[model samples]
Target chain A: MTNLQETKPLMHLLSATFDSLQSATPEQLEHNPFLQLRKQGLDALARTGLPTPRDEEWKYLNLAPYIRHPYQLPAGKESLSHLPQILPITTIPVVFFNGLFQPHLLSPVHGVTVTSLAQLLDRGSHDGTALGEQEHSIGQLLSPEDDPFVALNAALLHQGALLHITQNPSQPIYLASITQSDQPLFVNLRFAIRLSTGTAATIILDLRTLSKTAPTFHNIVSEIWLETESALTLIFLQNDTAQNYGVLTTRIAQTARSRSRLYTITAGNGMVRNTTSVQLNEPEAETVLYGLSVLRDTEVADHHTAVEHLAPNCQSSELYKSIVADQATNIFNGKIFVHPEAQQTNAYQSNHNILLSDDAQVYTKPQLEIFADDVRCTHGATVGQLPQEAVFYLRTRGLPETVADVLLLHAFAAEVYEQLPLEPLRAWIDQQLSHRLFDIVDLAADRKLVDLQFATS
Target chain B: MHNAKQPLLTIENLHVAVDDKQILKGVDLTIYPGEIHAIMGPNGSGKSTLAAVLAGREDYTILQGRVFFDGKDLLEMSPEERAAAGLFLAFQYPVEIPGVSMLTFLRTALNEIRKSNGEEPIDTRTFLQRVREAAQLLELGNDFLQRAVNVGFSGGEKKRNEILQMAVLRPKLAILDETDSGLDIDALKIVANAVNSLFGTIQSYLIITHYQRLLNYIEPDYVHVMYDGKIVRSGDKTLALELEAKGYDWLRSETLSSIELPSTTT
Candidate 1:
């Protein structure tokens, strides 16, 4: 882009934000104490200012668009009692509208506290973890000093969830967000999930927009803390409308004996960037990461992930797959780090992409940082089309070129979708895959594929 | 009690070359609907080239030839279209597709053929039944169907799977390209039995091999000897034995000496 576009101020874009949302936040924050603190925190953020491209993480994904646009965090509104009937599969469900929390949409479950970030901080019990002792870590991470959007979200996150699972919670909890923003504006959300010792559960956090006419911006920060003997699986589904712009920052710290797996699938939108980091803090800790992004028609989706093993006997693996068709561009940066003392560490990382059209573009970089002499850490990245032999093998069986292409594409995507163990999650993802393909291939033909002999014999 | 049907496949004046290098020169062959024709030749002979040319392997570009399957313009269609029209090729070396289960692969290929032929896809129950039967036909354990196609499979198991695929496909014209090269006696017997059963049906096969031993169980109606990209002679099933006893060297010398050679199917 030209320098003029880069320097333009967001005041020009402020006219589009959902700015009329101050009155509804108080009651929502009262139900969830975190809302009260968040409002105070966001007020402090407003005094500060936004960050420029000079920030290292925001280098490649310049926040010119975000910086140019002005937005106020939507305050927590009255209880959103009537949640949408069209619900997706989730373990622990949380609702946020226009960047504020909707508590009535939350399910009341045991062994877990379901309150606003305010109440959870004021009255919720903790085991002295970072989130328990330093609830402001998110605030610290998002302040204008570190991140402008973080500060904005801290000030604006009307009612956020303070989800704390005690020792070895047996069931998976889902956090689903359906953003019904009324206009083209900026929205930020913050979440902190802390798991105590011996706790094991799966979590699905989904972010989606209910409206499409307005141009919207969603900047999110989520932190996951895991203690010893804890197992956590996080699935992040960002199904943004094409008129939306989003940036998500996810950070995780896995302590001794803690196992963590993070997966993200992104589709639709003008530009979307996801930055995730998994730090293995102690020995015997393992991490698994698998993410897939499908972009269609003049869209751009980028995913950046870093998995670091700092202690000995730590193991981690990351694999990211991107499928871009038409005029879509994808950027993937995967890095695996092994500290010097982290000998016997096993880390593997790879990023693979498939471009369906000549107009599509992809930039992928997989890196390994190893200071430990005895560690085994490797990384690789590739962007290409389906194998010719694979295509021919299918064609020789009587499938048309289009059918063969779709089948191979599905096989490539199955690597990511199949990693999701939940049946409902898998079914939901499969439905999305069908629609994603419909954007490229004629939907009628794709719909007609059901007549296909699933088994040729 | 069997009524002879007209020949199901005919290859005439088949001249093929791969990358401008001539491989098959003036080769001819014909097979009846129930007949199994075995072509035995020395290394570098046109045995494989003929099979590839017929299956439309890109390597062997057909320079001069015509193949008639069910009296249609077979050469005009693609390899896949041919298969859908009742043609099956048991590859000499089956390709491996990791992350793809044999069950899914077979079902997809089978379904593609069925759909192209305007038939409904098999229901789960019927599909499973057919898989079980095909598995038994080749003595393959049901576990084999779950493994990736030919990946980590024993040498013998790979060949058996080729036959199993044929049994599942049930094509009218099955082409076995060196299907028995790497099989042990037991595997060879299982494969032979599979091929034997496939006979007496509407299906016929063009079996290519370097050895005459496979013909022991799955006897061929006619055996032709190919050498140097040309079929040098045509004879009954006994011709394979004669050639086995007296190597191709003997046939080469006789072809050069005979002044009044009959105008055979070449």
Candidate 2:
């Protein structure tokens, strides 16, 4: 948008695709309310094409090589034979295969309503008044112009889900967005979750790819609205294969006395960037954000978050930890803004990282802007290796060097994941993390590095 | 201990250094089975260095020396190997490891030792029972075992926790490095009694301290005085009383004037 010449070619290609896709719409869907929203998204993308490293938000990430590849739109009818092995999946998820929602695969949870966007658009055309009201609410939250990825997702929005909760579900609702493609593909998906007054619900957004051969780029945008006294727990498990890329942008707004907790665990070999923005719309709202990324190989995961305290007496606490090994990278940037009227707001944030190898890297930044004089805000960031003293202490207890390393790494991440409200999910995360750490340890052991260090006289 | 009994630990001409600064200069000591040897020294006299080096701490550089434990070359083994070989050092400052509970640490340690010995893992019930009995010896409750290892513990509590670990590990040779540093009289007696109760024919102890008060509770068979990184005197229990009465300064001047060789040679 600011006269950046490098992003011109892909921008033109995406623009032409959007125009052709719009022209191919069925005659019955021509009067759909999403038509206007799609046009708005296309215009926003035209103004600001694919983000480059020059952009402030994408400073540490370089997507030029990734975006340079010619990616065709998803075929809309990929097979779902690989659904059973998508994850060690205990619960049947609301499946979105190739960005298309499958209603038949969704199990009906208590007091929750799941509506496909395609169905909603079809009904909106018949009853324009109902769709018109929905459009207004969705439009305000999905401000596509805020981010290039959000705009891209909105422009190519093929299918999505809208979840409404009226009571607390007995188990967490699993929304799985999966991509299974042999050819390079581009997928865009959207979701909006609304909780009624005094209602509470937990959602697990698990994103992955069935195939690890061809690269699939998934851009997702989610909008969440918590009413007065409602609580929402959102956990994002991005465990994609090595050939996939993901960008998730979530916007959440909380009303009076509402609570929200977000946990982001990215253990994927592919690259992922998660941007979350929370608006404390009313007083007495509380939010907790926790993230842990155990990355290895050439993978990269970046988390960018912003919390706004617009009302008084709001509290927000954030802690993000990363265990990066090999040549991988993890980046965290957290921003907390307290307005003048938001007095008595208490905000705290901390980011800690452990680099096992010399090439492993972590970049962390904490930005706090407070205009109120009566607010309490504290932020800290630390990047260090494993403490040698602690390692020796563990080793002296009859644990081998590799075993000692694994135990310490597990203990380092346990501080964040121990707060998980769901026991099964917590155990799953613990197992997943243990597998990743053991991989690292086994690799180290294979290199005979442990032997070289502790060689006897 | 009779002369016919084989030695549990033997340190000969042990010269150790840290970052090029020599700490233990030609230290020699030998302990037989069922013997308790107390080494009294002032601060920085290398008493702690001997304990650390024996436990296979890698921070110190072993310039010239050899250590044998149960007839095996101790210097050639890694820390875990040394640990599994029944060598334990009660650290001067017990480390605080957050997020790792005392129960998990001990269980893991015991299992690893058992694993290396080709033994099966103990059942959870038996393990918990053992931990309960060990905790009771230190007057500690089960809640204390559930908390993070040594985290937020007082000085006395940390020292007692070390003894609790010693009780569970049941090492053949235990080296206590300044275990009585920050203990009150009541905590001192409790800790000393726990050590005494754990000791038997198969267990020997090397108690390192700055004061002889701990020896009053857990009596030592031999008392050695360390001065300037070397053992200056070795005698029976009355030697500890003499040193307590005369203080370390007397031993320092006496060693400087007489320049007598360590009694290990005799």
Candidate 3:
């Protein structure tokens, strides 16, 4: 890997970012756990460097455009002037701006303990207990040796959230992260969640941008641990702008009879990459991963998922759908691994894509590796265009060309959206998807046609 | 009779080609209000091509000639425009629109046609009432309206759905393109009964078929035999029976010998 990085020559693009680590406050560096973790992360990144197209996992995605420039750490200010409108729901929300946790935006909660990681580090610093041991245990859940982006995010981690659910929560909890800055900025965020035994809850993580043209780069890492017989639903909503770049890595581990479902909906961004990993460590554990991406213009979106069944009688299923239009591009890579001891494992994976224009492109790879002899595993992929016969059929019914196209596209996407567990959230996401897909001009013209027909009839 | 009145549709020396290959050559026909005209032909006799060209399908190109519907240039209108102008074609194979329900599809079509005629759109209650009546006429259950358009329908069900659409939209000129090709005897009777119930003095039909069996149920006032993209013979309903009894070879040989070409039919 070192020799490969030396040959690429673009690996130095991220080395310049390490020098900016001195910008951290002296007090933060004084903490032994924070200082050691940052040093270890930096060393790991220096060895592996950035990924190139030659890498098997990144064959379809290139990171040269994102890593060419050196970004400075943003010193975010406490400005409530540009906050997004709060969702109209009975839940608690924790807001962060440019990787800085805002205390004023934290809402009250009754059944869970929520705090910032910065605050935890501060408390550990004054208590004189060995915090490094605890940090090392949590860091074991992620493998930075295999991914350079994970190392980069860990090296620059500053502010994030820590949630501990001890009992079944009465309401959902939301973590809203807002990225905005006047100049080019790089932000790293970390989240650690622990759901205790027999507890059930839902958590929504929303990544949003205030300005559409702000040049911001965000690196986020989340690790979730589900105890025995617990159930949790984790939803990630990525709604950035055309000028921003983002990388998200999620790691989840399940115990005996535990259940977890991860849902991701990606819409707006110039470039976005998502990596999700889940491990069923005990028997009878199950996990489900579902995602939908709608891209237009010259935007690019990529999703890479890995699910490992390490114990017997475990199950995992994954389904992802994408629609690309104009000159946009998309990629989906899903891998399922069944260990030697994972007998009777039932794993299924599928990826479906729709290209709406001549220039649109999609690359899908669904892979499976089963070591057990008695396992039922299947994986497949499909890429296609909207049926011309269906479009002409609708046109013969008096629907205009654009209306017919939009209707068919919506139907293709509804297969994934209709499966959302929450009713209100599904409705909200459906509205957002409609607004993103149809322009105001097309919608207004359709309305006028409808009115004309009504008036004449 | 009504044949003395102004014709509802007039085709003059129409020549059409699909994929740059001529499929229709010098076709001439006319239909008046309140007349049922049936065109019978053998396979590859340009029967479906005529229906497709009338419906404004983009696959075909008009090499020459013209078509006028209700004294307006038909070739100049788009498919949707033609539909709104009270021209309906019951497709030989109905398309499957997976997400759109039958009720929504029918309602949209009916409303658009009504709008084009300078009338107000039908309210929900009235539309539902009309749909119930049409469904009952076609012997379809009420639950069928909620299913996706032709997604899992059998051949007979799909044919019935097309007639149900026609009943709701109420087009002035109805063109049935091989509607009885894949139907069983019972389904054929049901479809024939539906079309007969919807006929009126102001409406006309251009039923294109290959068998003389369909005319036995919905009798036609005129029967034309198409051979090599042209109508070679014309007569009353007895012509269909004569052709059915003697087979299309008799007409093919008659037309081919007149044109000085060897008969290709066996």
Most accurate candidate by lDDT: 2
TM-score of chain A of 2: 0.89
Model 3's DockQ score: 0.36
The 10-residue segment with the lowest total lDDT in model 1 chain B? B257-266
Structural similarity to truth (TM-score) of each candidate? 0.85, 0.93, 0.89
TM-score of 2: 0.93
Give the per-residue lDDT of model 2 (tens digit) for B1-266. 26787788999999999999998889899998888999998888999888889989998899998899999999999999999999888889988888788887888888788878888777778988889999999999889998888999999999999999988888898899999999999999999989898889228999999999999998998999888888988998899999999988887789778989888522
Error of 1 at B6 (Å): 3.4
- TM-score ranking from best to worst? 2, 3, 1
Off by over 4 Å in 2: A1-17, A20-33, A79-92, A107-110, A121-136, A443-457
TM per candidate, chain B: 0.94, 0.97, 0.95
Q: Arrange candidates by lDDT, descending.
A: 2, 3, 1
Clash counts for the predictions, in order? 21, 0, 6
- Which sections of candidate 1 miss by over 4 Å? A1-81, A85-91, A115-131, A139-159, A167-171, A438-457, B1-4, B58-60, B249-266
The digit string of per-residue lDDT tens for model 2 on A86-166 reads 344455367777767767776677788787776776454533222224542555675778998877776666567778888
Which CAPRI level is candidate 3?
acceptable
Indicate the worst ten consecutive residues by lDDT in candidate 2 chain B: B257-266
